[model samples]
Target: MASSLGKLSGRRVCSVALGSGLPRSRTLGPAGGRICLSALGGTGSAQIRGLGSGSGTGGVGAGGGARRAPWLVAGLAAGLAGVAAAAFHHLAPAEMVPRTEVASSVPDKADDLALRCSSFMTQPVTALSELRARPGDMKTQMELLIMETQSQVCQALAQLDRGATFAVDRWERKEGGGGISCVLQDGHIFEKAGVSVSVVHGVLSEEAEKQMRSRGKKFKTKNGQLPFCAMGVSSVIHPKNPHVPTIHFNYRYFEIEEADGTRQWWFGGGCDLTPTYLNKEDAVHFHQTLKDACDQHDPGFYPKFKKWCDDYFFIKHRGERRGIGGIFFDDLDSPSKEDIFRFVQSCARAFIPSYIPLVKKHCNDPFTPQEKHWQQLRRGRYVEFNLLYDRGTKFGLFTPGSRIESILMSMPLTARWEYMHAPSENSREAEILEVLSHPKDWVH
Candidate 1:
């Protein structure tokens, strides 16, 4: 029931590793090349003309990598090396989609929206390609972005761990091509980092998919295709200090069903800061950056969604919310699909600037084993939210033919639920509890 789960129970696993679609080394390679999923260049935002849950017959295709595969290690190194090499060679990054309305063509608003969504998905793949870290032609660009961004985040933390530098395991792709997954162990920057992505496809008629989807859940397409091609990316980064606190963020793209099964797509993603120990300035800075990104799209969005995030993320089991309030909402159907795509794009475009500085600022902080323990305990609550309440996890599992590995990529390498344990009196950790016990609106 824990959404943050282990490899789908037993039997044939979907993916052994989570993150990056790098080719398996010769020794690791199988009798033949890996199975193929789709030729679509990037994460395709197929317009879902409908949304409905169906009782269709089809199972998720299980693919390569063991959670302990050497390829992910190879890919992470290869990805980082590739990014460095690409930048050194002065390679130009991917072209961003035109956002200003004046610049966009009025002749076709629908197509314009599609173009913008595609551009948003393409840039991450470009970044991964520059890192030389993506899985080759055998894998889709969607798989590549999932893994490459993961390595980028993890490597940032590894740099801060002067001692106990965590070893990054191989990145893995889900069966039937949902997305990639990655995790690190014994890390010094907090404890571990886990990330994942989901890319689904259904080939029903645009009208059929839309009609069914309007019912509120996914409707299965005939022949194992999904009516809605939902792509999601989520990550959890835990710093090694009780003083630093942990953070969770997710970026996603959802398609509206087309009448004949063609997808009508829009993008969505946001980052939030969660500290075990509250630093008002750190919280303010985090929220302000998010506010800036939302402001780029609409002045009304930040306030509404910020309140939405706070309400949505509340953890009922814990009697407290995960972190201070941040932006969150679901089924964000905008009047002009193009406008929604731009909003989601803004969130993706905001990640590097918003989070990298925080990681750089705290990666090198000094902390003790006691602080590390507190971080792990907080992760337990993080795990609870994902498993018990995460709609994404339920969708990944309940959806006919959902990928197993990608669904549970948020699980940490190690976690603990201490028996009636408490941190030292008046310690940096207790200060964190005082904050978590009482949630506040950081942005306002």
Candidate 2:
């Protein structure tokens, strides 16, 4: 008797049969598309056809089948069950599998993203894997942006200097997160340039909270402590040539989780210029570049933030502004988080375009010892303002886990203070002082 077991082409198959007393089995190569289980007086055969390529037939001897038939049938049944399960798995629909299971199997894709992230000046304060895991998170997005901006600005400055590259420092805070600081000092072109990015989270101290409240922040605290997270990219570049002008810019995001589990977030920052000798054209170009970036988001942003920059970077006791103003804004949570992020991104990207051209234009310009002295005097004032009045500086100093080096990276390499020292009246030095005393609108 011969029993048909159906086609097995391109599929796995198993079968069992009983005949005479003998019991034996053999596997077969591809033989047409049909499979068969046959039994005769002296022989029994089970053939698997089209299992792969080519063709053949297989058989089992039946001499001892009477005694071993029951055991053979039981063992073959178990083997057939296993083979059926494997076939079901191989032919199962893709939708039947869980999405996470599919994603977890592709580690090569995750590694590729990590490799791309490594191109930054240093590794991110947050792990790349975590960043990949939370693509929609604002915190992750902000950290990645600042790190990328830091790397770009450092590379741009190094290209212009052609002699020195930034020295990288990666540090961590015991309390929560960490940061990367890149500095290029005493280069052929840049006197001192520092660009840093930090992602830190911890409980806000009393002084820090007081400062925040003073700035109009209202937070619900738990037991007099507020949990906060801050991340930003800040840079100050002072060129070797006094004519090149100094530039400073910082953009940041902050979040505070209230006692009730509610969260409040905001963005803040700006860019400004300080010069030993006032070059009207350079000032105009710098302000115009910033204006263009702001105009893309809101036309009124330039004028409003420009005034804020003037007011924020002021030397109160000296009764003068810090530099030719660009733009400054704080406590911004308006329009929409996405809209504000795009606006901030636009402004951050404007740094290189706004300032690098001025460097290229004035880096090779001639400068006298007197002008250098004037530059040093201006730097002295820069130090005074940052140490005494800069809110970011003060906040960083007050924060327990903040990196002190990054907080003070904005300070110039050298500065000078002389008793009752004054620039000669109506000279280029005094002219800049006059502008500093009275801020001007470089663009219409």
Candidate 3:
């Protein structure tokens, strides 16, 4: 049977008796250093000493000449052991590790990783047992990454809000696979925020197939249908303060098995911002963070994807963009699966540093009722782009047995559409509209 240990703070201590009848103890420090303590049985005096890597002998013992009674030495060792035991007991759940089993078993590396995954906000769509069993599979690896990303983003947003926590929903599709959706609504800091991860498998619909084909995806189909699996983490955060920009991000992996039993896959997603009121500093910071992440992988990525985002999120009918752009890419199966996965992971990790500071800086900024109305109207534009032009939204809606709530979680809670609405010339609202109409290159 396999087992795990509780959270052991500081160092781990183990005791053994030497052949010379002296009881020796070794403590493993956090950084892999070791301390060895031995007591001379006859004198009942203990020598507290340190040991370096591969060292045969201990260092000079502290208080070498001091003499102690046998009973005292015994009592001291027993007391220290008791304190260590108590510390372990109070720190973790009682069922995490049994006291009787600690000496006989230590958690292996696999168990440690599994324990971390188990700490996610909600149970993973794929069973933990299956994830551990198929560690080498790309599908399993992508699922784990998305789950980890979802938990991290959700936790970060909750901390910023300080008053409201996310409500989690775990649902399984009747066809195959499932997902976890976390939403925080009507909070003091955020009006609506959703972070969701899904692992869904099904046959692609003709509409979806056509959409993919339009993007240059080549597929060999039997009976005009292709079986596919898709997994990703997506988030849209709508902050209450108009000054704080709303942010959206998604990173996903897609695979389809062709009629000839051949398989093809790709990765896609990006992060962008939509602010009601323009802030050059905020826009620059957000784009710069994303650029740095992209630069680490490839210098060409930021420029290419930034323009793609600007074009992809455009509200074509309105003749303007959804927001000041970030990076967006799709049908990315190049450079090898492993390489692309790593690049996607890097982009996913960049979300926090890119957006959190803007929130902290403007979450408390003052605004009037008119400004609030302007914010709502701006959100109406956000709604327009997502529903009408967002590929992910369309794909989700077209999928069989898709969760409607999770698919629409990207929409802001409140929005207004006033016909013939336009900001006054040279007003702050007009400033943002100008930039949206003609996108700016914030990073260079």
- Per candidate, the number of residue pairs that clash is 60, 9, 0
Q: Which residue pairs collide in model 2, if any?
A: 21-63, 21-64, 21-65, 21-66, 22-62, 22-63, 22-64, 22-65, 30-55
* Better lDDT candidate (1, 2): 2
TM-score of candidate 1 versus the correct structure, residues matched by position? 0.60
Q: Return the TM-score for each candidate structure.
A: 0.60, 0.75, 0.75
TM-score of 2: 0.75
Instruction: Write model 1 residue lDDT over 1-444, tens digit each, in one string.
Output: 122112212111112222112223212113433212122222212111000011211111122111111112211222211211112232112212222331121224654332332322122222232224433321233334443444455445434432222222222223322333444433334344555444444443344344446647554344545544455567766554455546667766556454466655544455666776667887877788888988988888888888677666668967767677567756666766556655765665566666667666655455566666666787787788778776556655554454454455556655679888777889877776666667566667
- Every candidate's CA RMSD: 14.5, 27.6, 17.9
Question: 1-444 in candidate 2: lDDT tens per residue?
Answer: 000000001111223221111333433214422222332111234321111111111111121111111011111222111222112222211111111211121245547656556556646778766888998889988888888898789878766764343545445566777665566655566667777777778788787889889978899999988998888888888777788888888888889999999999988888899887899999999999999999999999999999999988889989888888899998899988889999999998999999889888877666667777788999898888888888887777666755444666777778999989888888998899999999998997
CA-RMSD of model 2: 27.6
Off by over 4 Å in 3: 1-110
lDDT of 3 by residue, 1-444 (tens): 000000001111221111112234333334533322332122222222111111112111121211111111111221111212112222211111112322112235557555666446645667666777888899988887888898788777766664343545445566677665666655556767777777877788787788888988899999988998888888889887788899988888889999999999988889999998899999999999999999988999999999998898889899999889899998899999999999999999999999999888887677777888898999998888877877777776666665555656777878999989988989999999999999998977
Answer with 1 or 3, whichever has the higher TM-score. Answer: 3
